[model samples]
Target: MKIERYLTNKMLLLTSIFAPINLAAQERPNIIYILTDQQTATAMSCVGNTDIHTPNIDRLAQSGILFKNAYCAAPLSGPSRAAMFTGHFSHEIGMPSNGIPMPEDLRGLSLGMLMKNAGYDCVYGGKWHVHTPSIPNQTFGFRKLYEHNDSGLAEACSAYLDNNPHFPFFLVASFDNPHNICEFARQQNLPFAEIPMADLADCPGLPLNYERNPYDADVICYEKSLNYSAYPTSHYTADDWRRYRNAYFRLVEHVDMEIGKIVDAIDRNNLWENSVIIFTSDHGDGVGAHHWNQKSALYEEVVNVPLIIVLPDKKHAGAELPQLVNNGVDFFASVCQWGGVDLPDGLCGVSYASLAESGDPGRTHQAYIVTETLFDKGGNTRGWMLRTQRYKYILYDKGRYREQLFDMCRDRGEMRNLAVEHKYQETLNKHRKLLYEWMNYHHVKQIRTEVHLIPGF
Candidate 1:
């Protein structure tokens, strides 16, 4: 009888020891992270933009937490995506531009590696702009899905879902579309550019901030005309600008249709109830804001990106969060929190999982900084932009007019520069101090030597 009692106790102790692990495995949700290239926060109809229709993306927003003030760590692709995968700023990972490969020593910091370590089946498809020499779909411990283009990406993801993956999987479907608008601008191949003036009614109108700001800092002006400048945008007439906007909208609509395919697959497979979906962009395109065309600028059109998180039960559905979120950095930590994995130490991002799950307006960043340290005509000029709820401040390492400040509440278009206004000097000083403190905290140092411009920029 005593031996029997000892055996029973041993069984109970063993069960107790493994109970939490089993529960964690059962509770962990499958994660699907959908990333689109160069898409702005305002591209969706739900975001109050009447110029384009993105019903699929809007559906995600309606069924999740829509971040109204989310920005990328960097406005360029390689750096921005590197930041997203590693939960570190671009500079911290030695990726300050579009094509620079991530440092060899930090490759293990990728989200795929972390998730794979945590026992999730990690798969990736489409563009992997993280500068890893291996194909994007195959690198970072992610099983390859699709490698060609956006359509293939959607098809592959849909088929993967249909396979009924038994394990809690982490899937990433990266799409490239509206990014093609860059080619449209570069080749002056606006489908409607040559249309007769009488038939121009179908084209979209110029943006509210189409005309360049008179008080714009010199650094922005120079950068706008540098690497990605397509066909002197300053010379484009109102009709031409309208055609450019029309092409951009069409590209966005194309990607939206592709996204719909994946959404339909999710529904058909009945994964919606047990899955978490996160949708965002690496950065945003200019789409004619401030007379700019592509990214690598500090303007709202390039820096602000769409971020939506849909929990397993659609917790806090349709909630619009106005808190400042650094999507590039926060994405890693949030996935870790949801996947029941430990967040690595020294990551710069804080998980937004609680906020998405319960609509908890917990602690948020007081200010968010977007950094640029790429090569330009004058050399490697570094720029820093600080954004708070009510104000924006921009500073460049080298430029005639190196500072720009705007009252975001009063000037959403950023048409007026308030840096020199004595009345707002206190506000300017506060933001400056904040930027200085952030630089110090990050241990940022000036890159005096010129970096090689990314090929084909």
Candidate 2:
């Protein structure tokens, strides 16, 4: 079952002639998927964020195709990770909130299970908050190396690679860090290491949209008002917000160091030419955007996570593609394709691997990507975001000004709300119809929404 060097979307051509110590060229490439918790898309230095130093994450971006438009399926740990491994939206899999168990039927068909059942040696090390705190062997199929802890997970993963077999391994090193920012915000002792803050003047300046906008979504205010423990920033001063930003960036750097360990482990085996490396986060932190300190908002900072993929042959190294990818489901698809496994029928994701092979830098695989969020509070508190080529449409189940539209290209900061602008009404309805059609196609009925059927659409 060795894989040949030449690969297509469907399968790897058959081959033979195995080598003992050094793996034969026909063997499938080892897939190293590294994940970090609560990391924003721009948190890495590779994406022009001067506030942080993420050399290890930056190195991956330098050596692979760094996708700028990668978004999470849901902006919470449990639901997002569930979508990622199951190749389905959170609601589709019956998990739209944190700590909810994944459906039993889908558990056996998870990404790890799919790859493991297909003959690849899969190892999962670190945080897996996809309903359960750790991946289950009875269903999820990956060999759990250890429970999630940043202190020794890196060394453990490195040692595993040193002791394991030579070729065709699927390894996951999921780290927990920047997530410690939660503890930092709570004013509790650091779970990892204490992030020392710089002087007030020396700290990174506040983002332009630091203050809540006049037309900010109403539910955002409602959610914050009720969740005091989560949104302590309600009492934060301008200087306090800057310090929070400083700590957030420092936490990002903390995780970056741990990531370097796994990358070094892969490099030690000389697997660069024979392994596929993918790095991303389950969800992104708010990083003090719009007076918000945590995730769950549909802001760009909350949903978009960094994605850097290093293919076995190292093709397209250093290329930053603008493809709009739902890193959750799309990642599930791409991994299956890269590992030479057939995708399960009815997955919403289209593999970026297939799109990348077309050799078109500007190729788009999705008309628009959706990010869903169901609050931890209660039922019917769900919200949805639809991000198209140049615009973002946000809708919530209950909230005044429940809809907001932003022209991402012109107003990347989302300073102005165009949902009320007369001239942009057509554009607004177009996106609303897109969501309406999407909900209908997916059989979503929880939103309690009714979009007028535009004749043309």
Candidate 3:
């Protein structure tokens, strides 16, 4: 047999390099993916929100695992969501803008496509933002789709579960409330509101940078950071911000109610023991954080998203994973891990599903988050950043290059910059190298960082 084993040798070598570490074959679990647009981590009662009641979402968390440090690669809806579907960065998928069609030549495949290929019945209920030329024909491989109907999406999803009793399903429940452009919050009260709130009702105090007007900080820090901008900020005010915040909370409450319906459906159908429920948002909104409204900045409000996963059988139920994780990308990998599906080669994510189940205190890993701002109406490049739990280092390049570093452990609000401080020089340099190395490794473009300003001039 060793006489002519040339191809066999290469095959063995490839297997050695590419074989998955977690080799345990698992039963296919019913997968439910729930994503709310522009909803921040603070909206959930499980994390620390007291303003609006989200008992259903809290129950989902209590019955599963909660991710305390999940961050979105881009804060915009279209790009963030596109990343979620394809498990590829927006830039990599040629979806840099909201209305842009995803290119055909892109080799990226979505979670639905993967699931469908694996023999699961794939379905999409509610928003499908990964628009493409084949869209009218194919909604990324979902055999059934109900796109952009945030109101009745939950009911449609429940109906699907009811209709298909025997077939396993990969269902996506995308809600459109909470994000600004639909004037979702404002239509409930305010109109075309664009100011950051000074305080969140019945919630935590406002961030030091929270603003009620558009200024350098708003443009550079907030707007430039998110992956999508649903609203225009030409006219904004304080009262407007208050009303908008109220409506935003109302939208979240509405979504929470819908979520309960789906959960109840699962319980009613006796599928609770075999289904896996995951709750997360595409990204966070500044709301009133840092004195600006919208996402597109590296502020905690824009990047940090709430993530919870409930696996059947009470496996790793009620565990809190504090380790940092980049959403969208890692989510696909986690799906494969928990669903017992085989993942194709060359995926850029690591599965953290075990952390939810093991409840092992020794589990900890370093994760890096990167955000780049492109040209707006005017031609200008924004900034790039890297964050760890203890230190947040930003490199800003607008017309010229500048740097800002914050010790999150000491000043979690990022009110003070330590890039120029000599004591933190070593830390700054270390993270800079890390960021640079990451950019090179991931094949992402390296851009200069920019200083953030408040919304009002």
Candidate 4:
């Protein structure tokens, strides 16, 4: 469908003018969803990363429950955010890469629409990259607050909250910062703030897995060589990567400064006690891991993102949960459920609300989570990552080394490939079968046969 038809300024004005008055919006506790762009799970100081100081995001971690092993549904922006808002995988929605507009049907089921239908006043601001960088207020059931800049988005969110629109509001303050590291990688200027500077000795050092993985997929090198616009770091030196890491952390901190404003607004307006606040990113950046820079490769640095949830009355405050969460689907499902919306049948997203509200930190939510990516256009070279409790399995189509297995417990750096070892073939086969089952259940008709071609099974 021509999704741009819904995003025009005229349509936005129309949505704002005729939007229903929801002063009596459902009283099922307010929900505040704060999202940042391209922030890795470890970029926050709360995670013990000494290179950055994110006081605001760190405060969220302190006042909420943090999930350590959360994965994105996809590793790129357009597909990832599409999965997030629609509660579907990239392939399910035909949004496998950036710039692919979301189908019209999913728009009606998005978070904003779901909350609105549940009788909550919904408002969205900042980056919505569900194909385009702009959100269509009419279709998504949201009133656009302001533009996509981080500082302005924060100010707009604070002003909106301070004005006290109505009860049970679903507010999305999506900031586009840390994503400026994309420009930093290309040696271009960061649009929002001045890029921080540091000498080689002062900057953070290279990661331990700075070198390429042993027996890594060949498609990675081929795609990098083919797309220098994304991976300009293919030729970067150690000092260069340190400098890159320096700037990336600074950009992350830059966004945290704006997040502080939104958090302060929630407190200033006395919405803290009755609100469910969630903080996360659409996807993660490589941050110099395994010589990788931008996302789309199914590395740990790209898929593992931060998931922090602050429930009403600060339930389980300062606790860390290790449950496996796919924020793309689970996020949509959880927020909708919390807003008192009954989900339609045939949707399989399992919500993490129980885990967050329960007292069992030792609870196991899912055996594993799947993350799929489309690196090249037309799905020529796509990849599926199945992450289990202690192992990570990766499979890519059309690559010489098409499979990689890592014991995540021992090799979090992913420097070793157990898929190459005959002793681990049985374990590899089990993961393959799991992926096969997942694809079959998700109606993935295109690649079921491709998984059978890996030979060891």
Q: Best-fitting candidate, measured by TM-score?
A: 4
For residues 124-194, write the lDDT of model 2, one tens digit per residue.
Answer: 88888876676665458788887877888898889988885646888898888889988888899998767
lDDT winner? 4
* Root-mean-square deviation of every model: 10.2, 6.5, 7.4, 8.2
Model 1 regions more than 4 Å off? 1-26, 132-138, 188-199, 228-232, 361-379, 447-457
TM-scores for all candidates: the values are 0.87, 0.91, 0.81, 0.91
Which sections of candidate 2 miss by over 4 Å? Answer: 1-27, 164-166, 378-380, 447-457
Q: Report the poorest 10 consecutive residues by lDDT, candidate 2.
A: 12-21
lDDT of 3 at 426: 80
Candidate with better lDDT, 2 vs 4: 4
| Ranking of all candidate structures by their TM-score, best first | 4, 2, 1, 3
Residue-wise C-alpha lDDT for candidate 3, range 299-327, written one tens digit per residue: 67777789988876656777887776777
Candidate 1, pairs of clashing residues: none
Off by over 4 Å in 3: 1-26, 106-108, 132-139, 180-238, 371-382, 399-402, 446-457
**lDDT values for all models:** 0.74, 0.80, 0.64, 0.82
**Ten residues in a row with the worst lDDT in model 3?**
448-457
Candidate 4 local lDDT, residue 364: 51
User: How many pairs of residues collide in each model?
Assistant: 0, 0, 31, 0
Off by over 4 Å in 4: 1-27, 376-379, 447-457
